[model samples]
Target: MEVFEKINYLISEKNLSKKEFADKFLSLNPRLRTTGEAPSYSSIYGYLSGRREIKIELIPYIAEALNVKEQELFNFDLEYSTEFNIRYSKDAREIIELLQYAPKNMIEHIKATLQKFKKSYEDGVKEPTSS
Candidate 1:
């Protein structure tokens, strides 16, 4: 798949609209645009429509905003990609460890945190201050 199609698929998988994705992208990389100004919605639209290309420099930022690794936005066969295994191995191990030793209360806390953050994210509210 082309980069544009991959990006669209990832965005859809995350259930984020173009505007929401762009907003998150800008939030994660404030320097994507001028200071105190959000990125133009039209730019995002253009990329999604394949009228414009996403800058290569922004790929990492976009991937991070979408909660994925940078390579996931490209067309690569995972089964043959050693880099994919190397990149995700640590994260997969950490997730396994978390599942093994995480107490029920701690699991609940993590779930609640994710739920609260998802709600706040959708509502455009500031993330609640973490203690």
Candidate 2:
């Protein structure tokens, strides 16, 4: 999906209306217009509708409005996500490379071990308590 589509999906996922999204975006004061003011509500609607391109400068404000990281807007596909992780995370890259050479049985055993680790970590997590 395109960036606008991703934004729309995130808005719906967050249970926000277009108006609410526009309100939040405006409240962030993106200030991308030539006049150094936040874009008008109709302009925000245009961005949502793909009638206008989302300015690069507004990405942070848009992300803040949506309560998401800026990369979340662009990371629409698994290929991009995997490439990003592999580029930035040595451990992730090594794990993927190692998995490629692992036998099926070994992979299954690894999965089980990872699942146990995850469960143990989750079990150890304590919920925050009110003072």
| TM-score, candidate number 1 | 0.51
Residue range with the least summed lDDT across 10 consecutive positions in model 2? 82-91
TM per model? 0.51, 0.60
**Runs in model 1 with CA error above 4 Å?**
30-38, 76-131
Pairs of colliding residues, candidate 1 = none
> Which window of ten consecutive residues has the lowest lDDT sum in model 1?
78-87
Q: Which candidate has the top score in lDDT?
A: 2
Per-residue lDDT of model 1, residues 89-117, tens digit only: 44554675578788899888888887887
Q: After superposition, how far is residue 34 of candidate 1 from its true place, in Å?
A: 11
The list of candidate 2 runs beyond 4 A from truth reads: 78-131
Per-residue error (Å), model 1, residue 61: 1.1
Cα lDDT of all candidates, in order? 0.71, 0.78
Q: lDDT at 82 for candidate 2?
A: 38
